[model samples]
Target: MRYFALATDYDGTLAADGRVTKDTLTALKQLRASGRKLILVTGRELDDLLQVFEQIDLFDYVVAENGALLYCPASRQEKLLGEPAPTEFIKALRDRQVNPLSVGRVIVATWHPQETAVLETIRDLGLELQVIFNKGAVMVLPSGINKAAGLAAALDEMKLSPHNVVGVGDAENDHAFLSVCECSVAVANALPMLKERVDFVTDSSRGDGVIELIDKLIASDLSELDEQLQRHNILLGTKKDNSEVNIQPSGSSILLAGTSGGGKSTLATAVLERIAEQKYQFCIIDPEGDYENFEGAVVLGDAERSPRLTEVLDLLEKPYENVVVNLLGIAVEDRPAFFAELLPALLELRSRTGRPHWIVVDEAHHLMPASWNPASLTLPQQLEGMMLITVHPDRVAAAGLSLINTIVTVGNSPQENIKAFCEALGDCPPQIAPQTLETGEALAWFRGKQTEPFCFRIAPGHRERRRHARKYAEGELGEDKSFYFQGSQGKLNLRAQNLILFIQIAEGVDDETWLYHLQRGDYSRWFRQAIKDESLAEEAEEIEQNNRTSAHESRDAIKGAIAQHYTLPA
Candidate 1:
């Protein structure tokens, strides 16, 4: 978390004799420019407060009268947080011939020889207040109320927590605020009690101390952030040939090819369960809709009806513990084009917000066939944590395998898939078959140049994990017919995995020509049945119209047109 607010005491903490130094004001201005909220929590009354710092809008908010009042400098608005002091409390002190100075929400006086009698009078009033001594000044405030409460209320308005707040003070009254902030700094000239409770004690007193703290904070934040990297198992290092190569956990993608009841889905579910335990967000493209019930999952598309693209996009934008996109019920012919439109938007979002720890695309061949153009779409340079599961490894595009960091094989009779893998992986040797694999057992290859694959059996999911299981359903037609249509669509869209099945199928068989047609938005021949609802169909038609018009318009003009489309009335 980053610091977003600073609450400092005004008198002894930031200035001397209620006078702010020129350097202190300059430092405060710099922090304000960076968008940090500055709050002054003090016991001074409104009039005396403005008199001390007459410059308007110098602070974002002020906590006047200790914790009893809140003031917004920008709007010049004042709100009282608690009840006023009892008239009897002040009148009794005066009855004893002891003059009490009423300052804002606080009352102060000198430590007199008859202090015990004065203390008894205060007790009799039945008011909750504390006496804070700072040199010769004795301050009294409401019970359970102090500078800390003032700062807390200010921070709450800005949606900032104590973990992201910093406070600086030098007197005993300021102790409450200092203890709650993430970082509290005490000036050299501060009281001994305040110094002992803070994190860092600044060497410079007054305004100079304020400048030193900000400089250190900015320096530490930038450096510390760079050291935290996204966690992934795939390793990348130099090969024996002194060439730079990747050692993926398995390979670019893992195709779980096997007959029905072969435990492929079970094995994949186990891996997903383990990854979720690590707390990394992952999205499972469940064609069968079996993984929706898992914890932290954001299910999309289903056995009941496939989800619209826009709905999935909305869920993706919100932070999720785990996201499972179930595309199981969509027609087989639509999966490729569905992915085509969906992948690009996902990639664009990933570029903006850093990629998910893993993008588990189940039934890979349905969305990405063997001849699809991988170059046209932006690929995550570091594909250390991507999992693609499929029963038809031969149907998955070979070009997509080049970026695989790992390959996990979960069933038997993988001779054809192995041949396809060797051919797609560039220079790779064939491997002897593994005789047998249990329900969760798999042959894991972690890198491109490795000689042997690691074999391990995955664990089972807990009973609690059943709620988030994926929604599974068969496609429009059989697998073979759908694969042919997807392969013939020129080049499938690799940008959006969800919209690949909806892309306009372009004519021509050549890979280059197919890729060109797909990129050019030649979607006249394709339509997705999954988005047949009235509102969704209209939106889809609008998108097609926009894509068609984009071909003849200038880029800037197109942007202006889009802006016009989304513009709202004043």
Candidate 2:
């Protein structure tokens, strides 16, 4: 169920001449029976809409008064989404002879040709309200109030996301709400502008068009239009010829394969950042706590504790929260079993909510080994969007590899990785020139492209993502990447393998020794190259160059800089 709800405009959309057809009603019922929700978004006032339409209860929610009011059909509850129409404003409109005027709890509406008078009265009164036009109807409501606002309020109350909604509309006023839905439809009778802008315009007009839409949703979830919604496709990178490479957020499976220190996490970070920016939820099955400090997501477990399955699921149910399931506390061999149990629950949740939109399985080989079979359910069919990253694709389960539709290889062995993946799938691999990918570059093969894989510059992330923050902060770094202090005469030979050790050693080293390294720009260089923290390095560079500051002052300043970004030991 990609689209979990249908939000339809009332006038000239779901209803023709303010009446819904029996066939449309039957279609709506059948859609609801499919376990999807329905919402009515209309510019008509609640009282008028209720009196004119007998099938009010057909919708779970009614976003009326053009987004100024929210009503729950089941509870018979009405909530004002915006402040009520001001008494003075209404009185002024009456005085101005804005004829055929009507007022709702929060809307003041009149037929146009009086819109000039409405605008003049608003200016004369110096009111902070906006006028919206729906064909011949002129409506006045608070600024930012519209069908979209109302629908958002209704969706919030329903615990649903706009990405899970499919909206249909007919006229100018429908643009706001329709634009926000994952899929927008316009009836055949819809205005030319609306029809041009919508994802699809129905062949049939009015309520019949709605039935056509509902039938399509129930039958296929509108899968035929998957490629048509290019607005939702995430940009992966640009190709060799400078053409874009995009991954559709829905029904996509990507394999990001590379060796350690190959910048796979860096590439993955950029993708996740894009997902978060779009407000889609993702669950990262972090086998190594690499994402514990990831931005815009709640880190479920840490180095010392593994979060319970129920806790992770409970947080994910919100449809807005992202979760990082850190497996640091879970033993290495037991990770596959934990993920085996977790995958089904996650798939079940997505089946119902269409969320945790992307599931990222890091270190795929270790977590879902080739020996671990998921035969009970077909992963390639059940899973929608996922990114599986591993050093060895052959080590990952064949079932898991089957889910991949696009293969993005990072690091030195790009061709080998793709060839190995193709062998694992028992398919012929595409040919490519034998070469090494430069730093921050990747070779991507999108299935069915009819061409060999091409190299592209990997897009960078905004944040200096401390990918594997725990490793840089606490774990041992190889001697090559570690910072060593044997300053001046080499009286004291101390190696700071990680950040915590660096800070402790800095505090104990003599002032002259500290000054020696600080003067040499060693701190900034080590931070940028070893820790992979560019911002922290810039800050350290600033502090290191200031000769007026004492060694102790620089130490505190540097320590504070690290603490500002990375969490330091208390």
Candidate 3:
């Protein structure tokens, strides 16, 4: 789910006059019953919070002492996340007669007028501490500690991502954690600046406001918050005018269209990398087994076994995890039927939890061909968080194309592809000329936007894109396509026939044979021309030029580079 956990401030948010209302308590129970977690993030001391609120056990975890202490209600365990206030510091404060001093495990606090004394004490002692203000209260904490850090710790322990959390607060200290959450909410009586900064402000004040938010979450899973997802928009690229091009994560479908070897997968890989970085959950339906090795995603199934629908759904139930459903073992003709069965369950899950935020279908034409009956599949009228990658747009179902609001074409005839996509839907194509684009560049057109199509360079992916390992190992290499190695006596036509055979030969060859290939840049040339992987080829070239070591070491380096790019058969 986009937001499966709610982190909330205690005072001025879930409580009024140091007490939670019965209504709010019931709402909390209902929210927990819905399988959502509740975390209390407050500046209050753990002991103080316990004295005021008897229902402390209702929350799963509590961050107390303004982010210095973490409390688990079920275990009744208090873990200090920050160092305690120094005894000398406390003595100095007391010696200066700083009245109304309150000290906790890791925090020292006082009212507003005493902040001057606190600051003086800090400076005089040369202490590495900071004071945070919340209305009349001033809290002293260790440097680098805040509600955000505490929430992060709690999420880490719980196996949750900050992007799946919705935070609500009403005070100055609330800003840090709220900013990190996927959606920030503020109560009606929140500080003016805090309210202005949040994505949504509740109509009711105090505990009532929290209850209102909980009700909304349960009713629609906060579907009304689709617009708020814009805050975490992914940058597509920059426009010709130097403006940034971006796309929101909700209620939007993206089509990455181009012919084979035109960088369509590369562009999609870049986008998926950004998605993973943002911690949004995505399920990749990999028809060609291309994305199995992408970072931060769990690869399900392989060539010998097709992923079961039940298993896929179970893995996706966790909001923090990404899944790549490899369709290598599934028959080509059976895919559409499988997807038809899977899509309805996915839609139902999203309806309940707003999870699996994106469903990426690589090679869209194969699964939803134009010849298939759209009515046979249970597709949504308004596709949200869908990305379709394809070489032939016209081959995909017209119904599928109708839901795409953004088209990113990455080939020489981008405008022509856009026109074909439009014609497939029986709509007039936007007037735009096709521009020649280099690799990792595209022409993006947002369906309803007034601006014309613009050329943009795709952002490089953080993780290496997965190459087609089986293809490199088993696929044919024509005589003209083979890479040859030269020797002392004569030219050895050791054809770079397949990755598996090439690796075996390289490993068994003598040092002289290995050095001969390395010195001649044969490995780099073969990687570029035979393997069709420019990035790996570039790395191989760098290794060849930089290695001043033994031939065996150079062979190991080259083999490592190839293994990184292609998976060798056992």
lDDT of each: 0.59, 0.90, 0.85
Query: Which model scores highest in TM-score?
Result: 2
Ranking by TM-score: 2, 3, 1
Query: Candidate 2 residues 1-570, lDDT tens each?
Result: 799999999989988888888999999999999999999999999999989898889899999999999999889999998898789989998888779999999999999799999999889989899999999999999999999999999988988889999999999999999999999999999999999999999999999999999999999999999999998888877867888878899988899999788779888999999999988899999988889888899998877998799999999989789999999989888888899889888888888888879999999999888888663353635467889999999988888888788899999979999999999889999887788988888988986667678888877776633445767888899999999999999887799999999999999999999999999999999999998889999999999989898998999999999888877668
Error of 1 at 397 (Å): 17
Relative to the true structure, candidate 1 reaches a TM of: 0.45
Candidate 2 stretches with Cα past 4 Å from truth are: 374-380, 464-570
lDDT of 3: 0.85
lDDT of 1 by residue, 3-114 (tens): 5667888777777888987887888888877767788887677778788787537788898776667889888888776666667867777777765455464444434444
Worst 10 residues of 2 by lDDT: 374-383
For candidate 2, give the lDDT of residue 97. 79
Predictions ranked by lDDT, top down? 2, 3, 1
Higher-ranked by TM-score: 1 or 2? 2
